[model samples]
Target: MSSKMQRPVCLLIWLFLLEAQAFEIPINGNSEFAEYSDLVELAPDKLPFVQENGRHQRSLPEESGEETDTVDPVTLYSYKVQSTITSRVATTTIQSKLVNNSPLPQSVVFDVQIPKGAFISNFTMTVNGMTFTSSIKEKTVGRALYSQARAKGKTAGWVRSRTLDMENFNTEVNIPPGAKVQFELHYQEVKWRKLGSYEHKIHLQPGKLAKHLEVNVWIIEPQGMRFLHVPDTFEGHFQGVPVISKGQQKAHVSFKPTVAQQRKCPNCTETAVNGELVVMYDVNREEKAGELEVFNGYFVHFFAPENLDPIPKNILFVIDVSGSMWGIKMKQTVEAMKTILDDLRTDDQFSVVDFNHNVRTWRNDLVSATKTQIADAKRYIEKIQPSGGTNINEALLRAIFILNEASNMGLLNPDSVSLIILVSDGDPTVAAMGEMTAGLDNLSINHFFPYL
Candidate 1:
């Protein structure tokens, strides 16, 4: 690499890393676990490929009036990602620079599949010498603005969509021939600790190789990180190793695979960088009270108790059988239920509540998930027919009522974990949904432990 080619990208990476900031919320921990409120959604974790030169694939006329025989090549000028984790809250940013190869206007698409729980906070595009930044607005208004920008050949991004284990969002910009465009996307998420470890999973699928590509991660765990390992099993095949440096409470991991290593084969220029780079670690913990850390007006509690017997679960399922879920949605729900019922433990008690305009239960109360009961549950799930409108609030309340009644009657073990899993098409009002969930949680807890 020449000094002549180094200044801009290096400066950009330096500035971007310095700008990556998050609320310093750290999770203190011990081996065993304590949890948040009663209700817990288990931790799940891991982009689409960037499409450049897709429309410009055809041979283009050269400056000398000769037609280039091969497809127009896309130039990925630079690629960089920086992740800064304070305690367990992480701020991540991805930056890429691409150059338009031909002397004609072309569309460059930037898409990435991010962790499902992470929310994109910022996105910007620098085209030629002009820069455009994203802003939050009402959906209708945002769409109208995006349309205007698209018409004016400006750049803007919107939306994150949920996928199996990841959600994706994309943005595209029209660049003039010889235009150099730089795209940056930033997001934030809290690292979750599950089964005694916290995972910092980064999804990587560049689809092609670039001259400069790197991922840098810095982590600070005040309770102290007990262990940190870079797992290469994020995807099928590829080497995803990082250089690790460590101190008592801080660690740095950098991965900068060379172009030779990024190639599919020694003689091939095709990229082999298509997999996740997983960093898994756990923090120090206390046997009692877990660990707590406070700094800069914010705090986080890391609690996972160690060596406790597994608590049996009283699990309740809330499924949507509304008109909108009439086809593929309902079909997938039934299929998922079929698999889940098959996995229930013998000591676990479970029931299902399916709702549309009205709510209905598969059983009068929770029952031990015996083979017979599991089989019956699967049958009931398959028979569910989608109709009418959705009743998300009432359905949640009804499910909670059943669990509380069962607990109060001694049918459910007070020592067991009570859980409600809702599978719905979608909620129209997010705020109301949150309120109802909070209210039902309080109701269930108060009913279960009336003296408290």
Candidate 2:
């Protein structure tokens, strides 16, 4: 071989060897050694082998080798979920118990799925009477703590939320043989408005059935409650008909499944819930007041007051066009905006502000949602292309300014609803001056009203 080629080949081989050695080194020297020592101490008798050059050397087994026993994975012992819906806010609590039935110690991964738009406020896990709880913190601070915990082989927490309306909570817990662990998760969600009635749903598909499963729902409404409905598929699953209290102010719904009951179903899977349960309430339109209905242990409340004229609204939609919202996200955003614009009433007025690093308005002022105006707005939304960095503070301030100008010009009525809807997937990455928080506060105090 030529000397030039041989020289480069030798250098490449040396570099590869150096990279391999570097990767084998412990990230934290003391912690790694302690972890290895703890494992050796725990099972010195079971490990019939010796360490040679950092690798285990196992001895050959005898002719009559001892049989090895297998351990079952952790089983969900009990799952109990309860929800309370008042007005448009729903608070849900879930309690789950997991048991390690095998003789060997096990590390179990627990996952829970939450509906989109729900905010998880608290989570707690208890193992052998030792409790670990999680609380909300700034993103940067939370990331730092998570990194530290993972490096030290301690419990690290995270949440994965990618889709529009779904989030998954995943965590790991170690359980000793014959021991049990308990987890409690609490969250809040706002019910979205449908044609007439408001709706809320509880998802129960966790890929495994609990030995004991139960759900309790309570509905409270100061207004009177009307008719309540449950799916026919779950009719045989509930304890009894929903019990509605007199005056229709409260209701309750309960569901409990016995082991024998689930066994009787020929097509029922051992690890899966047979079907999802849905609850619906139809409010009495003639009541002209809010109504509450209770059945069994479930409750539903209708909060739309009657005998009042529909209020006109001035809505400003500030949309994000940053690089991250390039493909599917931008497509979905544009489609949703088109649907919303089409649904606006003739008396309602709206304006669109598409923003990236800079902001562009569809019009100088809010325009009535006439047929022609709606068509023009749809065309404008169709042409919006994703680009640049996120400037949430600037975009929001621009919206507030437009609304304030409208109010000053007497274009907005005192009785009308004025709202600014700011949509963005990323935080502020560009700021012209002051802090982003201060800029947001100024916008809020001026003309931004909070909406679900």
lDDT of 2 at 417: 83
CA-lDDT, candidates in order:
0.65, 0.61
lDDT of 2 at 148: 60
What does candidate 2's lDDT look like per residue over 1-452, in tens digits?
A: 01111111110000001211221211121110000121121121232211123322222122223211122366665667777776556778777776676777788666667665676767777664445666554455556656765565554555434333245566665566656667778888767656666665676654455556666666665555676666655546544533333237555566665544443354444533545556676544654455556655666655555456788888889888889888888888887788778889988988988888988899979999999999999998898889998877777777777888898799986778887777667566788534444323323332221221
What is the clash count for each candidate, in the order shown?
14, 23
Cα lDDT of model 1 by residue, 304-414, tens digit: 877777778888888878888877777777887788788888889999888888889999699999999999889888988898887777878888888878877888766
TM-score of 1: 0.68
| Model 2 worst lDDT window (10 residues) | 7-16
Task: Determine which window of 10 residues in candidate 1 has minimal summed lDDT.
Answer: 9-18
Error of 1 at 405 (Å): 5.3
| Over 4 Å off, model 2 | 1-72, 83-93, 113-170, 185-200, 218-224, 231-250, 257-276, 282-304, 432-452
Relative to the unseen true structure, what is the C-alpha lDDT of residue 121 in candidate 2, on a scale of 0 to 100?
66
